[model samples]
Target: MSHLTLIEQSPDPEESKRDGQRHSIADRLRSMGQVRAGAFLLLGATLAALAWANFAHGSYDGFWDTHLTLSVGDLQLDFTLHALVNDALMAIFFFSVGLEVRREFTIGELTTWSRAVVPVVAALAGLTLPALLFVLVSAGSGYEQAWGIVISTDTAFLVGALALIGPKAPGRLRVFLLALAVVDDIGALSIIAIVYTDNFNPAPLLIAAVGLTAVYFTRYLQSARGLVYGSLAVVVWLAFLASGVHPTLAGVAIALLVPVYRPERREVEHALELARTFRQSPSSEYARAAANSLRESISINERLQSSTAPYIAYVVLPLFALANAGVQLNAEILASAARSQVTWGIIVGLVVGKMVGVFGSTALMRLLRVGEFGPGLTLDRLAGGGALSGIGFTISLFIVALAIDDEAVQNEARVGVLIASIIAFLLGAVIFRISDRLHPSEEIGRTLLRPVDPTRDHIFGPVDAPFTLVEYGDFQCGFCLKATGSVEEVHRELGGRLRYVWRHAPLTRFHPNALAAAEAAEAAGRQGKFFEFERSLFSDQEHQLPSHIIRRAQELGLDIERFERDLRSPAVAARVRDDMLDAEAMDITAVPTFFVNGKRHTGPYDAQSLIRALEQSAQEPQPGSSA
Candidate 1:
């Protein structure tokens, strides 16, 4: 039996390209996961709470206020239904926040000082201005202590509201808002710890310290046993509860302490070797060893974040909303709240305060040349984002519960949050819609051609074919390999009507051998064997090493010496480099990126979709050409 490597191996260049794409997709998915589903669930819970509180007031209050108690031997805990949801479930929400914060600082957008500056400064200004505005409005009133209410931005609701704008929504805005909200969360958690504690107990504080220390020590353990971490986390939470500090902070603390480093490269290579061995010789022992090796390759923090994100977003957050968002709404209460300083303070602080603070700070940064705005982030869009930041539902409500013991004042604050959120959403939506209309995003179907050097290019099908399909591809890309069959099918079906062109986009950072492979194809083209060599290169789809390339060249009846010379020639290398430069100029980042009739194909590249795009392009009159 032939020995096969369980995991694919590429030259250093190909390996770099593969790693780049993998990390890119993983990071995108992680960020998207935080915003998408969580937003809808939060909105649904908020709306349901509003309906229940108004339509079924008695039941809503009775159910949420019902007392619940837990006792084990000499230890006892007591909480109302609302308290349990806020204190216990919200802790999980904070844990998720902590995970995001750590990941962002370590690897995500905030990894560098440059990227960190904008969001950190924006968040600080956003937090400060809102509090100041609230204080100014309610300075002499006893409710001035509730200034913390407007300091938070409800990330889920804000992201969800932007989702309504569809995919054309500028990604930079979302990223900026997410980073800002995360920083906002850090500040909010700190305030909750320092300002909200009723009393201090040294015994439980010592116990919490000890438990956290135990968690920190677990980092040295080779095995990441979940039960050990879980037990330690519970102990920490319980200790904090007794310590009179918010128990929810325990979740954040534990999240920050979780190990975030993956196994080293050598360890990963060993795991890959073990996997190959297991594949070659099937056995129970080999399987267990391979599984353990593979599992250790990923960080415990990443694994935990992935596993718990959905529950935090969908379950814990929505439950918190349902428990907290219920506030009685009637004409009499509204009339009274309208006159209350507490209500107007929250309203002005969130709506006007967030807009002025965020936009003003960003504008100032740009004016001072301290930081530049991200692509597609214009002044109007920034204003829109600022307005949306006012949707401070979750943490705002949490602060209300902490800051105010008076039922009437709490109700007034909730009413203000609900009303301000609605107004802010409307204002943001209108501003964004107007901005989008004025500037408009780039659309597909616009011809975007780069000058092609016919002498250096590889062309298949008729040169005068009505429609042309150009592909920027790397030989080591799995997606490009999978796309080969679909491309072949499209070629066969389109026949003389379609022409195909291939351009090099080797992704050299990941795929080490990709540049060499492109050179081999160019060398073959030197002897009128380009198509044959290209077909053979992708045919096997498995072995594309230099030795395999030589074999293919020999099989194509080329003089081995001349072929070898051409492969190493500066001319061949330049040809490949030229294609890459063109790809970069066009901002093509990924392989298998296709262009139909000189216009970028934004739709799926499946055979059916490609055919449809070709046919549509054929029917339409060419730009700047008469029908």
Candidate 2:
């Protein structure tokens, strides 16, 4: 879905986690685990529900149907276990979804029309065509109103499925999918609010509006912001519930009102300063302030997401699956489902219709030159992702309860949803297998080995800049030193249109000090001075001594002890080794190798040649792109 974003590729690019940040290694690994574990948990829960319902049908029904009561002062609210999961718990889940949606619109992929157009159009088409297909297939099914079931995509499942599918160079595709998923989520939440509510009451809605207003203004509160927001959220939810609107929408309203922003550098520095003080003094009071400062440095939307994500992934959604997926299967029910148009409609809409809507719209946009996919996100991967978009699980099951009150008919829709999800996964798997095989790494010796990671890579321009120039050069090589001027000249001319990346390919065979110099550069990078250190190294390319390296650090005013330690550390050495390994993989045994927009450049190394190559790369269609 995000694969549709980027105004270019809609993928996550979290790619709505897409302003193009992988964050840190810990965050990336955590997110990956959460996505995978959530998907697998859902799968396991769905299977467990199905198995339990069939084996112990009465108990399954009894457990979820048991009513629970909550009393707040004089007010009393009663809910079945199923209702509690669906309304109260899922509201938190929806709130988490809303945080992501708001973040994307504010600073993620949907921040600009140029970045958001394709995904918005594609998400709309994805929603539209599915509804159309559902109506066409189940015209006489009496459950036509339930077409909303297939209008949403299960993004978590889609992303997790992609991880299992293991397509080559999935970074771009993943990002694009993430971007589109953000838009798709917006559509789904909107559908929930607009299509499902009945017997709308104006008075309570007015109260909800006021609560939402309070929520908006609470951001300005200097203290007790959380307490005020929590109270207002309850007020809004109660108002919506009383007004006959979905109470879960309160989560979204509150989330939208909560402010979101990237961590300001100045604030981060302040937190770091506090951290240093805490480290020296080790006082509880300093610790408290430091912790609070660190927390405040990040946006509340992110903080809330972080706090809530574990519960949503591990508890909320699995319970949802257990509650919603328990459809007791019998011969008669299975037979009726097979013959039921409602079942068939859900199947057709999700499996076939979602693919047609997502992929077709993407193709149309590309043909019209309105937008394009990112590099390494081939048509095959796009198609595969499109197919996976059909795996509509949570929402489909959710709407079955809302749109169809007949338990038997709900069972049929659930059966359709499960079957459609299976088919979509299989279809995506097949497409990935065929397409990835068609484009192997061996086919392109001229392409960069890895995608640009804004956090890790030494980048000199905007990470999302359309054109990227990657240079793999040895620091001590005379020719490599000479090319620095050319690189600078091109960056000066291209401005924001180009991002320049420098990678280490230290030719130790030719220059004995090159590897040490590469590691030294990385050590300087830890102190945020890689480029500056690089220029100093190039200016005195003949410096072949350890003392000279230390002298350069002294000259640059870097922390001498830390630099000295990092100069000997394995991580710094490994960082340099990574670039060396990439060079080896690309079969580069030379002083300087350059890649423009992931494609290696051949011929002259002058500023004019490099700029011309960059311009050419910008104009040319990248592999896996639908340009």
Candidate 3:
């Protein structure tokens, strides 16, 4: 579940139209599984910690206990190695989380209340039940306050777990989980800020408030943002540390104040202007101005999140696992933990409580007509996701450190965290297997991924047409061009009874101009000439150049400036890419792949064959009956 969209890769203006869309490289990179790789790194760290603690318990303890000091001309800061990783470096981790939360609320999963309510309510239930379970199980254990441990979920590991489980086209479920996890993080952070803090100093908080005020206004500044934000962030962190607040809170505070916005059209156009000027007269001055313009066009929140996510995932998180996951397991500690209420409380709260809390609340919400889940997010899949949510690692261990001061108690809690994570993953795997069996998603390519909507789909005929034919076609394909004629013949014979829908499945690897042409159709669609542009591109397929595409738009009486702007917009690129990805997921590797009433057409796609199929499908149970 990620709002992480593929980065926009504009087709080169200098290349021949046949050079095609270059997103195949990006698709290859995406297939390499960055999240899966990062998850493995974290798991490796956790395992290494276990091995070190069990093999050389003294070194594991002694190393983490080593005191480190930072001095800046009489301003001295001190921390044990373990504290430095958890308290200082993890502030950056929290900062990244804060960045995601801000982006998500503004533009990602939680942008609208209607779209967000189901997951938001489910997240609250997930948080509440787990903590209550922990409190009840740990009653009279002298550490019921450690309820925060069960309230959180390790998002990194949760995502990785989903990837490992490999559900078919889990796009909707991923979106729901992303929204739920964002709320879950917010709940965990609240618990940390409100429940665990001590000393309660208001004096330094005034200073922190002042620093935060400065941060609020830093958005208006045009340069040295890195230096400014870094300096101010340190000041704020120090202020919070002195105020007896967990200093990581400063990260959230700073991030919330940092501006987040879509790149302005004017700003992007101006950046392009600077870029053109630089190309005409290559100089350091022009280069710097263009660079700043490009950077300024995008918001700092996005830039900061993208830049830091790698380090946070690869370095900071692994270091956190190393410092916190080193529970020295032995006969005595194992026996003690087995009997410890805190241990069982954590496991039950996570492995059992989280599942019931998340999935049960979501199901109840749907039953009560509170909100809707996107298609494909069945209760069965949610059961699996809820089980995965129980893998509470990072924040769980962090809370263990803060809430339990006794070494023995700390060890017991850590043991519980580790065991719970493993059980949650295994249990989630089994649940997903059962879910997959029941749903039978294995027939992916045999049917449509999502039903066509009149608002979102490109169509030609009545919205309530009795017969529908959907084509996943490439603009540059000769076979697709042939199929279009057959489709026209079928439409002529069928009249308003048929609605033909076009979706992109651009074979960019072989037909470079295909992706660009598809995007051009979308761009033209903004001005009511999509089908006209499609016919023009197909009629003169060999002339499918950047110049040709623009000329076609002009000949169709499209506003040149508006068309150009729309052509390069991320929305346009994402639209084409979404179709491409959808096609890829359904294994639609070739052009002219047709789905007649949600079932893939076989044998031939000639007018006669398509007509017969549509006729037959009219009588069969139809999965893609139009609105």
Candidate 4:
């Protein structure tokens, strides 16, 4: 049988040009239509909400306080227009927040310890100090529930404002402001999950756990359907809502549990090669024909990473904002809020607290020898960014609704939010202006990592030989999936002599499921069905893996009970950690990194060269042998 080897596509001008063209089309569409549509929807929603609240109150007696009920026999939910927005619509907002939080941690800025610490610490201080300030002024008041209102920062509003200034603002300032806003969002979500939740309920809590477990396994089994995930997410949200945890947490929970990898890059290339060769060959073959069946699989694999931002940024986030960002303030309410301690506290906390907290924390970190400034950033610039971090509109509003129930108190908090946002904006602008004048320009440095090597090609040996190979791959990487088949072929051909050790080296800046998948595989390995579980990791439709892999083990007559036990065990997670550390130490930047007979080869390999390398190794004399 002629062996098939896979070669991962190195980035070429042709592919880059194609990608750039597609991006241009996407950008044009977004600018010409989506942006305008989104803006109109936002403005319309805001106006509708305001009109609904104020018109009902003014036009009719007791309209704002009128009790609205949704009942199914004995089941009833009773609330006002405000409560409906706060408790129900706001839950979706929080869910979106949760998704953003989960994304940041899993694949964005919060993924690495070093890269994560700066923003996290800044966010922590931004949340903590403002909350402390609010409590200091309003500890025994009716507005104590509104503590989280000051801890948020609105990236969209701030960025939009910056865009209005156009070329007058430096690009570096924009990047800095955006970073601060993203970190502020992280802080805001953490506060919601930790500070807002009431005491937990046992039954609903269990239900939430079960739903989460189901999502995790669904991704593992690779039989994930989007509707199923969406349905389960609803269940999880309802459970959390009933359990006294905010329902929004469920969105993030679902996002985290969704699988993201499309097998290894090697496997895709191998399949493609087999398909191409089989099409050219005259002989009838079963495996070759089966391989040829997956010809369109490569294109499908590319779509995996491309789907994340479009869904989250444009769809989920806008819907959430439309649902949550509305409040009506009549003259009386505004006058009352101006004098209310709750309102004043929120205003002060946001305007003063966030700036002081972020700037102080950054300064403290530098003084304590914890971290140095990032390239293209300085203390002055960071301080200016901190001032802007006080624009805590979206999350702050969500938290305020959760915190205070009284009309007077809510109005007071809203006023505080408005004033604080204005103050923060002006102050941030001033700081930025001063910093720009003081320091005109800065050179941006490259992020720490070497470019991928192109010289080495041989990675895996003969598929039918008895040889053990191990791979460390990132799920977000296209190349890693391309390398999958060579490892599989080695396992198939070598059998017992070839044991592939799978490890997690997820680059959190990209793939959310990489670490989880690695952990899941390790968890399954404990039950001696590692290969089966690994296959499901690739074949399953979900972003992660199915929760039913253990169930499959049960059907295979393995110890299903033991497998379930191991899935939750810390050892599995620990093994994944060890692999992550190994990757870090080896300076392996790209995914699908290989180790064969103590030799390291990065990227995917073709079959012919792999066979040649293995044959040569086999024939070479040992150091101790007399030839």
Candidate 5:
């Protein structure tokens, strides 16, 4: 049989079909989590609220203001319909936010101090400037404490706005705005916990702390039962509620305590082995063993995030908008709000303040050499993104409800939020349109692979192989580590037909140990053990440490003194730096970026995908050849 036929026949038909079905389900779930779907849901809910409030004012008011009460024997909890949505239902929304924040800190863009500095500093500036502007505009207006309304960015609306702007918007711009908004939410949450609480009660606070401690300890258990966690979460939320702290904070605390690491590499290998056995024997017992092992390979943190995100986006947030975005636009209320300082304060704070704060601070950072914008993000695009940040709707409404007691002031603030959101969206859309005309999409045109040098880089397989695969990767990146298995599989299948090259693209800002790891790999290459060192590094997490590097070097039977000397040599560091420079020139923003036959490969990096690409390349004429 041909190579393709042989590869296709390697896996059992039933197992492949099952795997395909599972992947289809995952893809559908991910599609539902897109920005457009969430945005449309939120918009639909807001429009429904507006129609209900304006067309049937009395019924709307009476229905939302209806009291809801829950009791367990002597203990009772009471809240109005609107308050129930804000205080109780919104906890789920905050829980999703907490999970996202934890992910960002652990593995996403904000994983390191340097990677975080740009967005964190920008968010701080974004918050401070808006609050200052609000205070200045509302001075002597008896609404100074409502400055919290101006400090948050509505991530849903902002993301939606970007989506509306279309694919002309660079991916890096989206990432930048996301990091900034998450950081902004963290700041806003801190303010809510510290500045808005009404009373202090130590007894309930102690109980909440105890609950959090219990939740934290659950991470160490081999199997954390959901029922146990749910009970503890309730205790924490109730304690915080009675202690005068916002109960939503309990969500954040619980999220931080969840473990985020996957099972060991050996365990993953064993799971694969079990899966193979089940595929061959087709027994229920083996299937169950393989299923459990596969489940354990993924982290609970990721599982929770994937499972809960769709609900929070589609249900919780839309419900919040329906309950709170209903501001009656009657002539009398409009006339009053138009003349109110609170309205102007919020408008100016959101529109003008956000623009100056985000763009200005970003510019200042570049000038000071403290931080720089990511690839494909220009100053004009940044300015437009800043304008979009001003579209603060959800969190601003949430805070206005908490901060303002006077019905008149609350109405004024709500009107400001609605009007300002419109103006900001228009302004941002115009700027992005202008940016699109000025700097059209250039990613595809600019992504070409540099010619490989055998003397400077590590290579595997035959040098004259018809297909070449170059990976620009960071050793510390989890995705890159995972890609190693796929790389090995391609090499094994292709044999002498493929040449595989490795280049260092260590994201030093995000991965602090990546630079050292790169140097060690290069040092081992000098001792004719580069592929061995690379395998050792990817197979275990311990290779990230210096002592582990030494141990690995000894195991590989390298010249100890020469290896140590080369690890610190300027030449080794230079080679790594050169690869990074090439990556930057190509705007390779993420790790495990692959190039197939001198063209960037943008699809999935699974073994199947790589093999297909190689097969296609083999059928094509070689570069610079006349067939």
Candidate 6:
């Protein structure tokens, strides 16, 4: 036999193989308890971000504002204060936004004209009104630059606020808000491109234009590759950056140009033709001849789009948020922004203007007979809901920093954002309270904001195991090694009744190996050794066992040959990629997270918490029925 077929490899199995695998009661309780702990941890991180920006390291308030230079010999990119954040980190955010835009325009809620119009109109109003208001108020020499500040809405902050409201929000209202947001985002992009670009260079603009055209013309490329788009996007961003237009706009341009529609007709016809050829002969030689032709005709467009979306969403967006959202503030800056009209205009524009513009535009859309109006909501409720648009803190702050070069302008803008956001929240709360008191309706339940269900297909399998435990862990995590004890305990305690499912919540910023680790584990699972391989993975903790783990798989009596070959397969990488998509859909932000019997858990579990969860699960009925 050839050397290629002789290597020992780990077995590949499905997650179903581990179904009903028993686990300890202690692991169950710990997993359950950590759900709340995870929430606290998430909250703590948010608070820490705010506090760190506002208080600690007051001396370096201008650290992020300081100029940084990146140069390649004669080629250099220099930016200062907030431009770097908006143009650099925000480019990744824009990239994510671009992906979302493509998804929506292609096949999402915005696929149809009726679905798209209301939001587009509402987005227009949301964009135009606040910007006009800001411009009107801050009519100084550089005041016009602040126009984009009001036009942009922070999707993260808006979505986060809606999540906090839980059951209080209606489904129609949520849909309306989402549509309006899409519109608002488009408006923001326009403002950045049209209003923000100062001293534009024609050469770079021309190059960017050509790059965009290339993406559009090659839209039908059967072998359309993400790397092509990525590389071109980088080039466009660089050109735009050098051209004096914000680099982030490159993300939008590249995104718009990338075609989302698949060449399905050709693909299907080709596949059929290949199938016909295969049916004619059973010989390996014939099979190879037919398969090669089919493979050649096979387009990677679907795979390309699928692969790109998750990278932009989970990897790029989060990293951008982490890098750019760390704003430093102090008493002086806060006070300055409190008193500055330009700052106040941005604050008022985001908080008051956003609410008014968003809600007003949405209301107008309803009146204009454009899309359906939100049910169970009156004008008062709509107006109140609009106040929540003040949650544009992130995008507002980002734009404010970009709009002004002066420290005073930026500080004042930040203050306005803070104040307006708080006020908006209060206004929204009051409206919700009044709406609830006057016309109580349970039609819109609290589950609307819950994480998207992952078990719809029994995607993992039925949890008939005695100990039902779900883990929110990244495969490349070291701390999860300590977590193995809890997993083992639950299996031991509740044999056959326990089901453990692994989830991907990789932290790309902290650990680079996480994505690969997840793929490896999934690949191992394909060969029936997920649990064993996962144990080996967690055992190392620091995640230093990629090659060694493969070597160890050989020792574990695995088919090291097939296993090693499959480990590097795109299918394996795609599995990890799929998990990442699911993770994003489910709103998982951190790693080492767990959920037992529908309850969330975080970090490593000790004995006591584990037992408590299992005991509690014992009292509760099985989770199949709707709660």
Q: Report the C-alpha lDDT of model 2 over 73-104, residue by residue, as the tens digit.
A: 99999999989999989999889988998887
Q: Identify the superior model by TM-score, candidate 2 or candidate 3.
A: 3
Judging by TM-score against the true structure, name the best candidate.
3
What does candidate 4's lDDT look like per residue over 472-540, in tens digits?
665445656656666566556555554344555664544545565665566556655565666666654
Candidate that scores best on lDDT: 3
TM-score, per-candidate, Cα-based: 0.69, 0.74, 0.84, 0.55, 0.72, 0.55
Show where candidate 2 strays beyond 4 Å: 1-34, 72-74, 448-593, 596-627
lDDT of 2 at 399: 80
TM-score of 6: 0.55
Clash count in backbone of candidate 3: 1
Which 10 residues in a row give candidate 2 its minimum summed lDDT?
A: 1-10
Candidate 1, lDDT over the whole model: 0.78
> lDDT tens digits, residues 500-526, model 3?
899887766566667778888999998
- When 5 and 6 are scored with TM-score, the better candidate is 5
lDDT of each: 0.78, 0.79, 0.83, 0.57, 0.78, 0.58
Q: Candidate 1, residues 587-619: lDDT per residue as tens digits?
A: 454667778877777667789889998888877
Candidate 4 wrong stretches, greater than 4 Å? 1-93, 139-142, 158-187, 198-200, 260-264, 267-330, 367-369, 439-627
Q: How many clashes does each candidate structure show, in the order listed?
A: 12, 30, 1, 37, 0, 42
**Per-residue C-alpha lDDT of model 6 across residues 1-627, encoded as one tens digit per residue:** 000000011121122113211221233235334333433333344455566666655533465558888899998878874466556767766765776677566645476676577667767777777777887777773667677766776665555454454224243455556656766777777776776678878788888888888777665554545567667777788888789887888877776665554223234445556667778766787677666555544333334445554454344444444334454556766666656678767766777677887688767767777774523345666776688776665566666656678865665666666667677777787777787676554322211112224332112333444555655566555545556676777667666766667655554545656655666667677677777777777667473335555665775678877776666554554445444444333334344445556554432366457667766766665442221
Candidate 5 per-residue C-alpha lDDT over 304-339 given as tens digits, one digit per residue, 9 for 90 to 100: 888887888898899899988888989999998889
TM-score for model 1?
0.69
Off by over 4 Å in 3: 1-32, 72-74, 265-286, 366-372, 439-442, 452-459, 473-486, 503-592, 603-608
Residue clash pairs of candidate 3: 20-512
